[model samples]
Target: METNGKILKAGIILIAVLVVLGYLGVYLLTIKEPVFIKHYIEEQIYTGYQQGPRQVDLQLYYITNAGDNRVVSRVDFPEYPEIQVPASEYGMHGGFMTYTSGPQQTPGSVKGRYSMRTVYLGFSFEEDYYEETIEITKAVIHLSDGSVVETEIGSVTFHFDEERSEVLESRGGSGSGALETREFSVKEDIELIEVFSPILPVIQDSLEMKINGRDFKDIEGMNIEAGETFLVEANTQGSRGSQAFGEELRYLKFQPKLRFISEKGTEETRILVSGWYPIPNYEFIEIFQYLRQKGAL
Candidate 1:
């Protein structure tokens, strides 16, 4: 009876020891550093522009264990240092708006390919946190042998909201190359009146306009009225009498002369005529908005 009791006691002790060892093994495999490691960024935020001296900040969220044992991630930004300009640069007559880039001029450097950067998330253990800092446009995760693995974790992006506005602003210009001019004749018996608005390069330094080989005094703050048809001519500051037309960028004076034929039955009455339009191809005018948006002008 005593031997049987000893054997029973030993059996119970053995079973208890085995159970404890099994639990420890499972714990090590499931929860310890023996398993896979993952690194990832969760989210990011972009702050706006700064005047004169400025710095942009990006916030990133990170996590581990992306469903698999991965240690790297690569991210690419095609639009880096977004192209943005001030309102004044767009040729809008207004207050001063200045936009300047970095000392090395890093604005819009990514030609066909954008600026790039890489993040190196070194080996990580389940208990370890993976980390790095990279100032680049492209990012990637890879094994030591350079095998791309999706398991690697991390996220990177710009503080885009504020910078995005800059790219939207730098557009719009009515320059020399963009205009199409045309001439028309008025009757000798009819009187014609015209007025021009402020010119580009400014009225003081811009092109001088003439009619019928006679230099009409610029009516600043007043309108222009003429009699009959007159030869229209334009010249720049240094080269006077050079009717090279739009060579020098100038603002078309507002309110040009208007004329039209009268009705035979109403010979005693005057013809009501007004308004003139630039004679450029309509298709080109249609593209102005697109060019302005793209900052191409």
Candidate 2:
């Protein structure tokens, strides 16, 4: 009986030791293992003279356990939203031109000269979160003449503090017209390169002007000779939101002012023109392929 008792006690101690070891092994494997997750964010800007849609690619990458790379999501940020640039209010009759004796000026007789100025502004947030204020660090303008202008004329501020994004808090004044002298002559159809700010996932704003040449005689009893110097001024404002991740767009509203003045500043005329213009829209296939090659997607 004593020998049996000793054996029984020894077996109980062995069983308790095995149970503690099993619990420790389970804890190390299931509860204490280290988990490492990494995220990569990228932004691509597209600014080409092509007639098709313009796009920006915003990609997010997720990696687990070091070598696992996967494209968790892709956002397509279109620069241009409209099928066609917004038409001026005057429907194309708004600039100075030589007069000729003909059958009352047909629309075909008048040639439209378009001047577009695009500003690419970049902003950076203090932190990765959007709750902070955005700072405007870069402002570049592409003129109609293919010349690039850099100025501090206008101010761009983005308010993400609110539920919705509010843009272009203020744009206009002597500073806004800083690129007034740089005008490009456009005949038939011309597309200005879409501007972009890489820091953010969307386009900030845009401005454009259109002038029409008409026969000096078109004006009733007004004697102005051809080749007379004239001043053309265009003031415009427009805004659009990012279309990343197939998100719905909040259509933009544009305000534009067009005017023509004689070189002497004696005569001035204001013509109604449309303010709303098209913004570039993007396609993401190429962007996706590029990122995939970089092992970022």
Displacement of the residue 28 alpha carbon in candidate 1, Å: 58
Q: Assess every candidate by TM-score.
A: 0.20, 0.17
- Candidate 1 global lDDT: 0.28
Model 2, position 296, has a per-residue lDDT of 36
lDDT per residue for candidate 1 within 20-135, as digits (tens), equals: 99678444323111111111121112223443322322221122211223322332233322212121111223222445474322211111111111222221111111121222
Angstrom error of the Cα, residue 159, model 1: value is 39
Off by over 4 Å in 1: 1-183, 192-194, 199-201, 218-229, 236-297
lDDT of 2 by residue, 1-297 (tens): 999999999999999999999678444323111111111112211222233333321111111112111211111112212112222111323312345586323221111111111212222232232343322222232322344433222112232322211111112223242123222222212211122122222212333232323222132333333333222233334222222222321222222222223334332222222222232232233323322343433
| Cand. 2 TM to true fold | 0.17
Q: What is candidate 1's TM-score against the reference? A: 0.20
Q: What is model 2's C-alpha RMSD?
A: 26.6
CA lDDT of every candidate: 0.28, 0.27
